[model samples]
Target: MAKLHIAMYPWYSFGHMIPYVHLANELAARGHRISIFVSKKAHSKLQSHNLHPHLITFITITIPKVDGLPEGTETGHDVPMELNHLLCDAMLLTRQQVEEILTADKPNFVFHDLAFWIPQVTKKLGIKSVCFLVISATCMASGIKPFREVTDDKPLTEEELTTPPPGYPSATVVLTLDEIMSLLGASDFSGMTKLHEGFTTSMSDCDVLAIRSCTELEGKFCDYIQAHYKKPLLLTGHVLPEESESKLEQRWADWLQGFEPGSVLYCAFGSQYVLEKDQFQELVLGFELTGLPFFIALKPPVGCTNIEEALPEGLEERVKGRGVVHGGWVQQTLFLSHPSVGCFVSHCGFGSMWESLVSDKQIVLVPHLGDQIINTRLLSTDLKVAVEVKREKNRWFSKESLNEAIKSVMDKDSEVAILLKKNHLELREKLIKPGFSSGYVDRFVQSLEELAN
Candidate 1:
């Protein structure tokens, strides 16, 4: 095996970091030297995971306070929107520090999350840089196509929101008006700043692109990106562990022993997404009304006070033994795959969707910001494997709608629901087998081996 050194810069959340670490581990298994540069907050997880023993090294890079960013919060998600913008606005200022790190020991390649000024930093180092688009390749292609239009000074008028992009399945690859606004920052792009602007430029100039998704799921989009950009497009599948069926059964036996099979609706919104006080209350009432056994794995909004008390009246007592409320993290993959879980109520984040889809479980899509809505639409409309809840006033959803959506999918007799479960199982098996996503990961490793030569 060739001695190759690779570095990765991950987003500041568990979902993003977890996949980056997994990819790093896979690369390390190929006898490559890997260093993952992470923020201070993200450092704890890598340390706690004790991943270095698996053959990858962790490098902690501290982003000093600059341009009004709080001393402790390094990544955008750590602080509120305003501060996130402040830090991103100052991306140019962080260039010096990135330069310093690159000067010390430049790796053969750098893999960067789509945050910060990654592309700019790579160009400065004269090294090959590949963006690890951790989300679906379809979303990446959509983002890039619109970006090209925007860069050419042909800003898509507000009317173009409904018009589907040519050469893709009808409505399979479309963005809504609100989504378009969020992307263009009509309502003050809470996540945009000078730093973001610089970073986008870097992505446009990157040497290669890799997404943590396989062609089996996004073949059309994958082919489009390769043909349009003429750059090597790499897919690493979902890169999650293939937990044995027996292993999952035993774990479920421990946590879901008393609950009825296919009765409990598992609700988890992933790491991001914060429900306003009103919306949170509505959800609690909706769950209670459904009267079904349930489990909620939540990382509450960063600063919510006394989570149990925050629920609607009598919600905690009614759902008492029948419900489980978790504030911190848990093994979601294992939990979702449990036979007791009838359906998944998710924030529609890619990771959560992957867990739900790969487990062959019915899904209830409740999306918030970022690529969430796009993924939800893909599942609900294009994939026909999920049920979606309509958003209210572009803000919050109602309890009644939420309850109905849950019931519809949880009802096994419903043809759509039954079909979804079967389709998901088939898709899951394909992804795991040779000549599919797992195969893609193998190909990626082989390419890296060649690159090292």
Candidate 2:
């Protein structure tokens, strides 16, 4: 096979860029020369990951900032008030920078994130641009369909998705008007529509499209998307490497020495997703009410204005020794891999769910917005690996419901819960074994090589 030179353009967010880079590392290990096009901030994080010597040889193309977004305000959640204007400007600017790099370096193919104008730019250069849909393909297929058909205020009627979607065998998980209104209240639905428009165009135009999900988890949905798009759709089945058992166990030992096995509930809502004052308080109360030891990682909602005060009244004092409230980043993949962690209370984000599954932990879904609700449905209904929390009138998770969900996941004799535990562990074992560890990634690289041939 000929030597491959691959270019990867990742969005600034840690979640967006990390997995792409991880894939790059995997490809590089197979003797491909990789070039990563990313923002300066993302480059910094990549450096921090302390990549292996062979991977470090991969080139980086840094996109300059359109405006000075504060140093650490780099991720999607850190969007400035003038986000759209800045983003559109950055796209054009990055296009020039990316073109310059491609002209000089001449990579065999390019990998691009869904964000930015990569598909448009790469096409102009006559390069094969492949898009990696970082989220669940199931949700992408469902969400983008409305954009293709819905032309105006006449949104998707209930009847359309109430039954099994014509293309997919699974029953459609329909959201009610109340749920829609609830999501609209907290989220920027108009902005979301625009985002999907870009996403759909990228997927349609890219030479290949891939997602960071497993076939076992989303097989039917993946097939539906491939059938609908008639494009190469790849699933990398959670491309995560297992940490050394000794190191992982030691880290858990420090935290879980005195705690009972399967007695501590771990609550982390991923890198993005911030909570409003009320929601944060409800979460605090829920963990407290579970009557189990817990560890929580708190992110100061985007601008970091008055986060400490956002807590419930004396809630910190209540859970003192029995719980933790950490901020900034944590070694989350490591934390999840720990033996003492019994259950995960998560935002149902695609990345978080996969990590929870790979770590062999059950989930208590508390979806805030986005495709999270759909992911939650897949977890609860399709995978039967988790139970969803009930919502209040506004469809937000309430303290009472969260408390109940926590108790249910931790319940010892719950037949379904026990079965879920057994299944997730089995799945975890399959993923880490030699033929499976890099199975999906290896296939993708092999396909790229075939294209070159």
Tens-digit lDDT track of model 1 for 342-438: 7789988888877777776788988776667778877787767788887688557888899888888787888877877777777778765655655
Candidate 2 positional error at 159, Å: 6.9
Per-model TM-score, in order, reads: 0.87, 0.86
lDDT of each: 0.69, 0.69
lDDT of 2 at 23: 75
Which stretches in model 1 have alpha-carbon errors above 4 Å?
81-83, 90-92, 115-126, 146-156, 160-170, 182-186, 189-200, 242-255, 301-303, 434-438
Off by over 4 Å in 2: 53-74, 80-89, 115-117, 144-165, 176-190, 244-252, 301-310
Overall local distance difference test of candidate 2: 0.69
| Model 1 C-alpha lDDT versus the unseen true structure | 0.69
Which 10 consecutive residues of model 2 have the lowest summed lDDT? 180-189
